[model samples]
Target: MTYWSGFCSLQKEVQPIELTKRQEMILQIVKDEGPITGEQIAEKLNLTRATLRPDLAILTMSGFLDARPRVGYFYAGKSGNQLLGEHVRKLSVKDYKSVPVVVKEETSVYDAICTMFLEDVGTLFVVKEGGILIGVVSRKDLLKSSMGNQDLQTIPVGVIMTRMPNIVRCTLEDSLSEAAAKLIRYQVDALPVVKEAENGGGLEVVGRITKTTITRAFVELGEEATV
Candidate 1:
């Protein structure tokens, strides 16, 4: 039987639901031990019946917990045939394309632009003299540098690149959510995916993480994790 029948019968009208921490805690409690009552939950959590009422109401409304007049509350398994675990597993980053394009630090801005256009990407990784990532150059950066007196054909990317100490990077194993959060937090469109060098003094650009890459990965693989 549906767990929400009790609350539904009482309300008869639809209402909005907002789950708070306390409500979430209560839901966990019911999932762990129900056919249980709000009073039982309150007693276990050391909260009064009055204080637990709102939490119970919210949990019931949100479809996480269902209430019954006398049978108490119970954990409702996934609605219909949907499996929550399988749904989450399908959203993993392990199912997508993640290769990043890169370039050497000494390469000319002209070369970087050419690579960007040829690869149909917006950012290029700038590696050190040893093929370690030291910077990144975006299409806009090259365009800005080329708009004036700078000679794009002769100018090295390092001159206009977002260099070390300022470049934000992500590890190859970071979660897509975490990478996306960092990009949003830093206001950057791309991140260099790097690995620590064996000597422990530098990082090698193994790949690149960009918004477009993330989006495409999500669309193509049905996953959101991309770093």
Candidate 2:
């Protein structure tokens, strides 16, 4: 039997699922450049062919893609474009919350905690003396720091913060889908939303992007694009 047949057999034995990130990425790749082989898709994404086979199987079974004996996978029809477009649209950042809660790097940990409590937020973006995003502090970070012998009054917010490279951020133009993908892919609670400063320097955060924001936006839009 063929790949499609194999996938169908599996689906009959189990319920279908919405496409996952890896699956969605595979579909986008195939839809953009098809008549392509599984090996090719795996190579492009730095995935092993064995790892990608399951995703290809699900896509073919769901009718979003078709595989021939040798021609590889092709978009089954117009639904492919519509689905891809919707995915692209949802990923855009313009549709979601853009206001960020920020604190200076030198702010006391005690004061930061108060800010978090008053604002009812779990994380605080740390900005530099010049207003550039430099790091982030989560409630857990504060709790850990506060639990120790270090004095909260004397400790700078930067002392307990997760520094740059550890922090995740996105631009105002990024798609909600992309943000969600990063959140899951990186296993993080929130992303700092930043914009390039007019002076052409570092990122200036305009908002705090969270998974909740993406979920709410997705629900409001009511569009599902193959994961």
Candidate 3:
């Protein structure tokens, strides 16, 4: 069952099938004495099994109860963390990736360096004219290229970038855990989030994901689980 999420007053509209006074009593009986049979619960309440059947069915369908053909009913609270883990796994790159900082592969090294500073990013995605990803440049790469008294304005960044076929990337459909693993395994400051090109045979850079983004996601997840 799904919830009607809200910040406050979950008492009323949270459950689609709201429990009645009798149903609440039945739930407590099941919690206190389960893997118990329906007949046992009815006997404890001094009611007939037919009269309590509907309430049992409602609670089970609403996810407050679970029934097995031979094992009877048991509380489902123990599986809450498992459900939360599923939510984390379902998060995708598109939900967390930030806007990409991009520069043309042919852009002057001086301009690319300025773009990096202006964008406040440790890395920059290098793209061709049609926004197709071709290479990547980092601050360390720029520093190394500048050490020989080179003409930054005359040289294009493409000459100093980590070229295609070596770039570590992830698509938007990829899960957050997959992206996180790539971030750790590759030891890159950031990843270019891309999608298949409309014309095929290349990828178009759409966004970027970094360590900070994943950390923030962890913080949010913790806060939400606690709440």
Candidate 4:
């Protein structure tokens, strides 16, 4: 819950940094005369280095310029779209993951379906004791099981779930771009975000990354860009 809150807060914080006129001038000067020192830039603008510090800082922080220790500042040469792509690629699965909807292996298919509907999630991570992930159950899995003659209340989800080694999953360190790619390549609606358990047990289910999750991210990015 705390993590999801933090993620929402982060999305709200991505306001567009509007460049000042002098900041625009600084960029043009760097573009025309790059590999140029900060002192040189100030000299060209007929301003003191101290007076231009904040503008330089803003440009650098906003990805409009890159600064070197001795070599000085240069144009980053990234368009707004490119910068947006770079930002999206840098998003970590851990940062954006939503709390996973989970079920135990022994959980009945009926109960699993109920949980899925109540939680409003398309996929459920099947975990053993200690939250160790064992398998994944999707909407299709439940639908298929429900169509069978077998009793839904009696059959355990473990019987129908796509078990580990067959499950396509992601780790905390994984980039969101990788998670999105896996979703496309596997044609799965969601991927469990997992991590190695401290007790050397197995991959522990931490959170979830879904098609909706990725879509939300893009939507948030669009909102930020337009802000």
How displaced is residue 115 in candidate 1, in Å? 1.3
For candidate 3, the 10 contiguous residues with the lowest summed lDDT are 1-10
Best by TM-score: 4
Q: List model 1 lDDT by residue over 16-127, tens digit each.
A: 5556778778878776666577788999889999998877776776777765454467666644223323332333333332677788777888888999999988888887
Error of 4 at 164 (Å): 0.9
Q: Which lDDT tens digits does candidate 3 get at residues 76-159?
A: 664655544555676789999999999887899899989988889999999986789999999899988888878999999989
How much lDDT does each candidate structure score? 0.72, 0.79, 0.84, 0.88
Counting clashing residue pairs in each candidate, in order, gives 0, 8, 0, 0
Candidate 4 per-residue lDDT, tens place, 1-227, comes to: 69999999888899677788999899998877675689999999999999999999889989989865534677798455554555667678988999998999999999999999999999999999999999999999999999958789999999999998899999999999999999999999999999999999999999999999899988876775555
RMSD of each: 12.9, 14.1, 14.8, 16.6
Cα miss at 100, model 2 (Å)? 0.5
Stretches of candidate 3 exceeding 4 Å from the true structure: 1-84
Native-structure RMSD, model 1: 12.9
**Candidate 2 regions with alpha-carbon error over 4 angstroms:** 1-91, 223-227
Q: TM-scores of the models, in the given order?
A: 0.56, 0.59, 0.66, 0.70
**All candidates in order of lDDT, best leading:** 4, 3, 2, 1
Sort all candidates by TM-score, best to worst.
Answer: 4, 3, 2, 1
